[model samples]
Target: MRFSSTVAFPLAANLLPPLASAIRISPAPNGALLLRDSYDYIVVGAGIGGLVVANRLTEDPSVSVLVIEAGDLDDRGEDVSIPGSVGFEDPRRYEVKLTMTEQEFLDNKTRTVSQGKAVGGGTIVNGLVWTRGSTANFDAWERLGNPGWGWSGLLPYFRKSETYSTRDHDISACKIPVPVHPVNGKHGDQGPVEVGYPNYYYNQSDNFLDGVQQLGIPVNEDPNSGNATGATVVPSSMTQKNQSRSDARTAYLDPALGRDNLHLVTNHTVTHILHNSSGNAIASRDTPIVNVTGVEFASNVTGTMMNVTCDKEVILAAGAILSPVLLQISGIGPAQHLKDLGVNVAVDLPGVGSNFQDHPTLQPVYKYTAPDVFSVQDIVGATRDAVREEYLANRTGPWTTPMVNAVAFPALSWVTDNFRELLDEAVNTTSNLPSSYDSTLRAGYAAQKNETLCFLSRTDTPTYELMSTSWGQLAVSAMQPFSRGTVLARSSSIFDNTQPIVDPRYCSNSIDCKLLLLGIKFNDHLIATSPMAALMPVPPPGFGTADARNETSLDETMRAMITTGFHFSGTTSMLPQNLGGVVDPSLRVYGTANLRVVDAGVIPLLPGAHTQATVYAIAEKAADIIKAGSSDAFPGAKS
Candidate 1:
């Protein structure tokens, strides 16, 4: 049942024409030749989701898969391949900066949201911490109309995505009650993505987990099995032999690249999904779903417009922001918005770009006055040079691990005293919107609010992620935020560098601010604990002081610390269309046939843990649905 191997299925590719798949990187209009005139599937955006889906769909020789990546294939240089070079490299090489200016909230401050723009997507530039959310986090997906999307349903695919390596974790090194949890499901024997521990983690990482235990919060040893609610030593998506980052580049795309049935075009921006109601295999005959014909793209550098057709489907894996932007510009969005852009509306679907959700993070820096354990704070000058030399010579050392090692997930009851009070306000976050808010969106939020209430009432739910990263910083992101934002196209020209109006609307809801303030409160308690106080001796300036840091002072620090966690989702939600969802349980867009979204965008709710692991699983399951030829593979998907 596992299909991660690169060996294509032995089937006749009679439907696919002869292709010159050996395409060298070239300038346009010559680059258009890299793409065949037609393909069975044209996948937009080569992010983690796109890469996984493309790899699986092409396993059948009868299918021709074309992956159009807006960013070029990574050089696989140490800057990207090494785990420690995360913040050191120029991000523009791997990420796109979607600038948001003068927000309606957060005192009218501006922020820039960055997403993976390369062939491997964010996995190339992201923190290599490998973790999954609670079982309840995914079970909520099933409750939200997606049946086969719960924890039990997706665990097999989660197992199908990685090969985990055993580690002799030094329990003595960790001055804690529990050392390690048993790996549940005993999964990970056959997958391309490598999941293992770093050889050169900071000595204080174990102590951080010990501090959480001292705080009365249970440390979850292996939440990857199911429930995730405590602090644990986070593993990395790193190679077992070299300890280099094992991202979408090294894992899925590279091994599958040599196959003749698969073709990938880089540095081309997909502008629109071309359609005229002609070809669609999965469009329901009873509905008014329009047939998706092809995609219109342009060279990122030369702006040479080109088009290619697809025989079956046009899959949108362009992440939360651009995927919806592509739909709106392609006339498959809100009728009024499309009319404003002077584009004819393909589908009058109003939920194309609404319900934008993200893990809004607030990072407050604390000076490590404790005996210089040589963490990210002191990775400079001679130490940096010495580590670089050791890594280059021996291929192991401080360079093998990113600054983010162990993260603590705490429930609201453990972090704050006003759990009941906060839960009441949290449940109403998505309700009672202004007149401008769509009625269907309001209904969707109402349903989502019920899920939020469910998470808050449970002891297994970790409402906040207390993470310590580089430069003596304590960052916290609300595991499940209630605020809803938008990603509307300013104009119908994303291919020409028209930045979509990107706004997560951080702190638009009152509960979101409360969650962040509670995080600040938790940081104060964390550093005060005996074990953590030894590692992070100093807290942020005068802050983290119970009485010294009141509402106004903490609010000021929060305003300065708040930033997007980069785990964006819910723009193309997978809920019933009546509930203001863009995609159904089948992941197909509301009014478009053969146009499915398989990125974090379709995840209606943000999981309590990092999105990296869950996104891979999403793509894995998505490939199954596509291979089964629609929702027929999924029970109860007939809805």
Candidate 2:
């Protein structure tokens, strides 16, 4: 499997429909008919991670696997299947939006965080961009405490998750040349997920590149080739057969549903992970360590709590936001926080909900004065009706990709001339962690800060990203955010009727804002340059000015426009237990046997890339670990 990198590459010419999903495993309203009393393994949250694990574990046929999901199967046709039908499709049909706790840094404004509400998880609604940030991003995971979790160690599994395609296909239906990435050996050929270039490349790709190259930033050509510091065209996870969205369900789960060994129960939220008790409803304090035995779930339709047993293990693939909340509610989080929430402490892991990180984006939309060029802006604005009709009728055109066709990943040095000063200020500040953080969390933040500082000083690793959409909108995200936050549970019971307090603490570190503002400065210059100047003639508001904006004005813009790239991770980090880590290198919950987290939550650090592709890779690697009996395979395992 290969993930191509791009800052702002075009998507056109290489297109196909979708693989036949005639045999989908519909969501079982109740597990009574589909589930067993005790399966070899129980996977919670039938999202990317759980589905991959279930499909692989059941391959033995000798063992049975059960999957529990909180949402129903995706039934929204185009919204769930189309490649670039993100904002244009039914927005919230398959997603559950959580109102995050008011961000103190963002002027006490609460943002809505939307997660996939269906069985397929976030894959059901995320942007179809598939990429891995850089080699430094994954290598940092190994530096945090995990062995064989680095870039080289994980690339094989990344290759094992997707079938990368580079061959040209018919593009005449839409009357365009097929756009494709180079077929390097770094990609895979026979995998579940489909990885390939879209069928329509935006004409402005070369123009943007020319304008950027004038600034001395070289083209990376491939963002996933261990270097993600330049502009390039990225690949999307779409089926080569029909040019439809290829997600966890369409790629991995749908094809394996006929196997009797695998069972899935959707529309059921796993409230708590049942464990070996000290003969009590809540395990006694004396028995701090326990093994998971089963799970207690509440039905979405009935709201009734039910239990199912598992003979081997319980894997949490609920995602970064929910996984840590699950651990806290399951008596396995920070002991003090659990006690305050009236929950018994099974494992006093302080890191269960700490180290929360995400890519904080600043979305600034710029309207073009004219739509004369060959960019998505030109195609969508000039011939909107005709292009949409062509895409829906023939499955080709600019509609196959989201409006955002190109991206720019520049190191701090390229972003701003004051890099040394920012690094110095960051290094001298000592701590950028949240106030409520525990000592162990501070230790972890310190380690992460050092890694971030290293990334900031480097010229090849991108610390910020700049992307442009078809609508003349520009979005930038701080790639390696220094600030850390927490995901605190509201109560011990899942029936609390409240979402967890997800405080990403965006822009808490002053340095993050500086980086984003610098990114804006870089984009401002590029838009005014020769080739891009003709495409998008107007300068963005509060940008592209001869005079630099003041700190106060920039701060106001950041506070008003800040949002997420939806690339969340690091709540239940994989690191040393003593360093505020929830899961060990083997992805197991510390101090608990037979319980593991196989999702984005365990990623110790947020990767510079979109999370979907990396999540697929992590899930693939985790399946291998679970099947090998983690304890015996990785002796340095913390759990």
Candidate 3:
């Protein structure tokens, strides 16, 4: 079946109601204008975190907030708004290219790391999963010296940004059966963001859930509930009836367009945060005075430089990958690395770009007996036409299906236990530090020691702290890895075409590798299980073996297939200044008083679920913290 590539449709050109008056952009005199000449707050990157922060902070009419985005806003064109038409939309049409770097990972040379460079950031390009970190995961944060970050503390904000679709009770019941805990707060009825199950569903999803259950995994009606350790059909971060993608723009920017206090600038690349030399005392301190004087950026649209001063604060919400790079570019990373790139160090915070983490995933494809599963051929043929017909006529069909509608979470007890033991042994072996060593040898030793220690420390850590199991395998990840990686400057000149260093340093720790191995094994087991058995061609050909345990030798092949789960986190981590953290609990950067990082980068640790809901909750709580002069009310605030 071939789908039609062209279909005429009506568009609501006036979807966005005009504000009191449209703010026209005057051409730059010669270069772009800096924040010093513009607004009170400047938010860099328009991802979920940035949008939320920008939306909330701009609520005060007295304070004008400027959001500089690297990408263009969604056109709400047919391809972007129609379900299943995502592929038809040119990926480049929605992309704003950031520079790329040639880096090695797991022996693979030259990997390109791309980030969403457009108005909505990654939210526009992502799969739109709406999972939140577990309650246990949040509570663990409080235990880890960051108070007020637990599930109870963050529930209000979760509810605040969500307007869940109450329409499709039947579909919602089957997909997400778990009832919301009243104590956790109800879904926000008046929130700007919309959350609900996709407007359509495929039969295979239900069968997939049943297959995992047959393999001894329990079926979880709600993956968002604190416990995400079983097979479940989860909800997408999308609106219901219209099937329009619920990106950051749809959720935050659309509603905020008419607000007088909010200003969004597209095609602007923030270069650095301007500091006030007059306030040397605050500037020298670890907790930098939050008083950010200005921000400098390059106007991508005009090829000119600009500076904008902030009267209140400068917030960096550039996602896990770019946020750290932005900091390094601004001279806030390790002094040595900054000097190597010939960039002056504004702050000597070693942890500024450290602790990079993401849920690395691998796709093990199977040939199902059923004919309905989508493939590249189906996307181009008659099947596509039928699906498109149904979609345009009734708003139902394959267009509504996410890449994976149902997911399984399996606990591999054996792998978990072995990993714990291995980590413990490694830790015990490296307990005492050496007094001295050759510089070269010392560097090698330091790298090895860091990896081993992170693994060991992570294993012994409580389940809530880690999330997921230490088992032999788990198909799904709720694993909160403790290993830290770094992001540094690759070059001094942005115009010189230098790519920012993005070392996810994935599985640098042996324990992380082991956990990922277990995850694959679990995936194999679930596929082999009876209920799901019909969907599989055993061994999954190249990716797996008949004997899951013996297939451990295929670790290299598995790693090659692994890509990010889109859960990038922990860069610009929030810890006390003395502990090498960039931000305090108040989400304020060290040595900068009025500047704060209110996004996932401020997340000190990875949570056990998708970051969307948690990011929202964090923004909600941050709004309150920023509103109240005292930071003590929030988690991770310094005493």
Note the Cα lDDT for every prediction shown. 0.75, 0.74, 0.59
Pairs in clash, predicted candidate 1: none
- TM-score per candidate, in order? 0.91, 0.90, 0.82
Which digits, one per residue and each the tens of the lDDT, describe model 1 over residues 114-221? 677787898887888888888899999999888888887888888889888745555223232245555756357678799876666676666667777788888777
- Using lDDT, rank the candidates from best to worst: 1, 2, 3
Q: Which stretches of candidate 3 lie over 4 Å from their true place?
A: 1-36, 86-89, 96-105, 166-186, 278-291, 370-379, 412-478, 496-498, 536-540, 547-552, 635-639
Best by lDDT: 1
Clashes of 1: 0
Q: Predict model 3's lDDT versus the native.
A: 0.59
On TM-score, the stronger of 1 and 3 is 1
Residue 90 of model 3: what lDDT? 53
Compute the lDDT of residue 484 as modeled in candidate 2: 78
> Candidate 1, overall lDDT?
0.75
Q: Model 2 over residues 1-639: C-alpha lDDT tens digits?
A: 111122121233333233223322343675344446788898998889998998888889898888887777766375466665655545446667788888887778898867777767888777778888788988988898788888888888778888887535554533212223553755777889997666665656656666777787777766777788877667778876566788888677778756788877776788899986442222222233687899998775357677889888899998888888888888888778888998877767788888988888887765555556554434444386687667777777776765554677878888677889988987886456776677878888888888888888887788877776655666788888887778888888765634778888887887777777787777778887787777755655555464346756766766767887788888889878667888877788777767899988988988787888898888888888887884436322111
Model 2 poorest 10 in a row by lDDT:
1-10
- In angstroms, give how far residue 290 of model 3 lies from its true place: 8.0
Better of 1 and 3 by lDDT: 1
